[model samples]
Target: MGSTYRLQLRNQAKPTDPKHQPYRFESVLKVLNNGDEKLKSWKVFVGFRNDEYLVSASNAVLADGTSLPANVGNGTVFAGYPMTDLKTAIETAGDLNQIQVQVKLLGTQFGVKPPNVPLPETIQLANDVHLS
Candidate 1:
């Protein structure tokens, strides 16, 4: 048994036809649990789900028991719009060692239905929220 945290990504945006590019996002985290410290981040390949991407500081299992890689992508780039905000938050955190993450698109809404549960209405609203 060890420490575990949740990561979520939501597409809070309406589909804009043309001109507006398709949206994509990622959650980058610096985690510290007990006495161990590490930096871990995950990028959404298909960034439209409003689901939790669970992470563990020790051995943890996905709901389906799928294996996830330890390090997925390089995180050196830190500038411009969305990434700017994400970078600032990561840098300013007083406790980057132990953290949880919930990431969402800036102007969309989403919901989740667990296994065997009835799916709820799709969320559709624009909000200005800081994940801090």
Candidate 2:
């Protein structure tokens, strides 16, 4: 795949719970620079609806450093730590796996049902580098 993604709804024997909603889901977003030389201090925005509760995230951190259980229904932006810039295949010697970031997000909602997807409404990625 050009870009990697993971979207799944927990289908437990009893997937319904009262903590927030009966529907629980997780999404993985991998953003990269497929057409650029490199992206400096890159950040990615993932949009959603219904004001879902963000249980947790891994491999990346929110720009605001919001702790777990944050609200992400409106949308959220995050960036990879330690290695913030995304190098292109050339930079990594054709190692595509080393040129991107993978983020895992867990959340919950109540209104989304079958026939509808439980994924981000929109995803935008950009670099924060500024030219002097």
User: Top TM-score: which candidate number?
Assistant: 2
What overall lDDT, based on C-alpha atoms, would model 1 receive against the true structure? 0.25
TM-score for candidate 1, residues paired by index: 0.19
Residues 1-132, model 2: lDDT tens digits: 124557855432245655534467777788766754777677777777756778877777878789778888888777777668778877787675678777777877666665666666777773444221
List runs of model 2 lying over 4 Å from the truth.
1-5, 12-21, 128-132
Q: What is the lDDT of residue 75 in candidate 2?
A: 84
Q: Summarize candidate 1's per-residue lDDT along 39-107 as a digit string, tens digits.
A: 233222212233322232132222223443322121111111122112222454634323322332122
What's the true lDDT of residue 38 in model 1? 28
Local accuracy by lDDT, each model = 0.25, 0.69
